[model samples]
Target: MRSGTAPPVPSAPARRLLLTAAEWAVLVAEWPGALPPGLSVEVPGSRQRNDAVAALVARGVLRAPVGGPVEPVPAVAADLAVLRRPLLTVRLETGGRGGRRHGWFALGADVVVVVLTLPDGGIELSLAPAAGLGAELARVVPEAAAVTGPTARGGAPPTGALPLGLLDAAPAGRGGPPPTAAEAALAGELLRRTAGSLDCLVLGRAGGPVGAGQVSWLATDGGWVGLRPHPGGSPRRVVDVVSVRPADLGTWVAPTVAALLEGRA
Candidate 1:
């Protein structure tokens, strides 16, 4: 198996159910024998199915028909139980003029799942989960969260939280001044100049500027750019920008946006 961190702890009930289910599925898939008399098999409360079989073996509900080596089912179940309450958190950051696109950051008990989404574009989710479920999910959604950026290539950016200002400055729409020719031209210029550097570009109705300051761009060679107008100013003046690269961009952008909408960011 590929090596990586452990997975987040599922709830106890969830974990138990998941383990039970895995036991049943495995029994049905492999053993195909009658369940011992008066012995009850159940799925864990969590949705994990693979763990169910492991739980059964751990519980001693199923024994090897050959009477050779007993599977270490109980030990595995205990391990799963221990992981049920693992602590984890996810963060997201959105950039560009439109705010429709974003990046994600996930910090779980043992792994992380970062994602990025571009306006009217495809989604990119990255898995950094601990062992167990997180790793299992990584296998399930390999296409959804492929790591292709600098970090995957061993050139990660400095490890630091994205500036709150950058998160706040995510665009309200496509990163254009307005429907007017000048605004469209400026927005196009920004995209043209920063092609491949920017994960997304947007232009639409701008939200009022943030706070007392007007929107501005942070200079970076290859990163993200956001645009928003100054707070309390006319929406027309609302333009914000930030810098992000195509790879690491997803790691902190999408999950943050999801968290914000969920009132967790």
Candidate 2:
């Protein structure tokens, strides 16, 4: 690939690259931020590792020619971009002396994922089902009902307005166990199905305290989405307001990120 050339976002399941643990290590070493955590990649010797890199390049999962630097193609970076494509998006905001906190959400047909930004410059990912999530959100913000709906047949994906406390809650209770294996699988499937399309909810970088309430998103058709806020009433200190909207995210994904890299700066 050329210096400024961007790779495409993989949408088809066939575009998913299945690699050995050794290959994954090589790819991660070349592009540090292009893979999710948990896999243990341990390979021996520079010769074998180099061989794996060459094989990945040959397979079109990466782009590296001779002396060129190894570059991750869509097969490596598409997961990050695809995860950001949701069926419906909801912006959750709360403020107090502890400083302002924001929760950015992407709702899919089966999964409700949230990326929360804390005052301490930390972020967290949470996952839940639409039905269970709606029940929880209503506890914090009664007007959260407007955000969630039947997502089948072009209907809007489920959306919600709730405090981070309620959202971070596990099935056991608030601040309990993280998502189980089953939940994680569902979340992964949701991302895979929504990749490279705008029919789902799309989330973008969350604004700061001094910024506007609504977050913006770019659609695949060269237009903007999420400009219109979903109808709802203000609740209270927990969830003052919520905005559920749409946007096409796959059209703008750069093929080197495994996760949303915006707002980190």
Candidate 3:
């Protein structure tokens, strides 16, 4: 081959191997730590681990560190942006007393709970109250609380009644079928309690096909917590009053509920 002339193109599998090597370089640069256990790049063909490691060495992205497994040069801002896209954005609002002020970002259906920590060491929790949809809300979140009117003579307002309005309004540009009967009832209760304060509340049913026996619940600060049980559960029950702050409400409420009801947060 002439000097500077490129070799014939490699086979498709070979080309894929090259690409995998390139991706490994990128991953190393983004994560300087050793490949966390169980982390490995997929490759074409049945290649041994040594072969993969050798290919990465040729790419110059991976280098054996004195005391570390492998390290990449510090990533630039542009690279950092690319890496950040997959990350979940969590926003926390703090400012309550006695470790009671906290919020959370909960994933709908997934049941992933991202608890929000406040500056005052307060942790937000949602619970069902006696005033509104008592145990109903508690069944879903087990922490949601109903909020009646203002507090009694000397007591403060309910724990979860922030001034942000009940659920944030649905966003625009969203087109989907209406909620199921159970979801509709849940949304209705939320709306009834927060109507004056909020524009609307989103109620999202489980994405899968709606079945006949899905259950639902509602909670308000000081109000009752109502539980409309599924087929096997006992009759609906209204539980005693619990306390909840507005900040803690969303943490317990499912994001699907927010997304389905109001298109936006």
- In terms of TM-score, the best-performing candidate is 2
Instruction: List candidate 1 segments past 4 Å from native.
Output: 1-182, 190-223, 227-230, 245-265
Candidate maximizing lDDT: 2
lDDT of 3: 0.32
Better of 2 and 3 by lDDT: 2
Q: TM-scores across all candidates?
A: 0.26, 0.27, 0.21
C-alpha lDDT of candidate 2 relative to the true structure: 0.39
The 10-residue segment with the lowest total lDDT in model 1: 142-151
Tens digit per residue, CA lDDT, model 2, 1-265? 4697689864322122345655656754644443222222354479888888788788887796588787777534533343445544555443322234455454455555544443344344445554343432322221212222222222233223333233222543544345555544433433322211112222334333221223332121111222223335323113312223221222222211112234323
lDDT of 1 at 93: 30
Error of 2 at 149 (Å): 34
Please identify model 3 stretches exceeding 4 Å from their true place: 1-115, 118-265
The lDDT per prediction is 0.34, 0.39, 0.32
Q: Write the per-residue lDDT of candidate 1 for residues 71-171, one digit (tens) a residue.
A: 43453333323223223322223233323234333344444433334344433333443433333222322111122122212222222222222233355
lDDT of 3 by residue, 1-265 (tens): 5678688864222010123433443444445443222222344333544565565557663576788875433322222332233112122222111122222222232122222222333222222221222122322232223123342322222322111112237642333443345544544445554311111122223343321122222334333332222333322222222334333334333443434324322
Candidate 2 lDDT for residue 253:
23
Point out the higher-scoring one by lDDT: 1 or 3. Answer: 1
Candidate number with the higher TM-score (2 or 3): 2
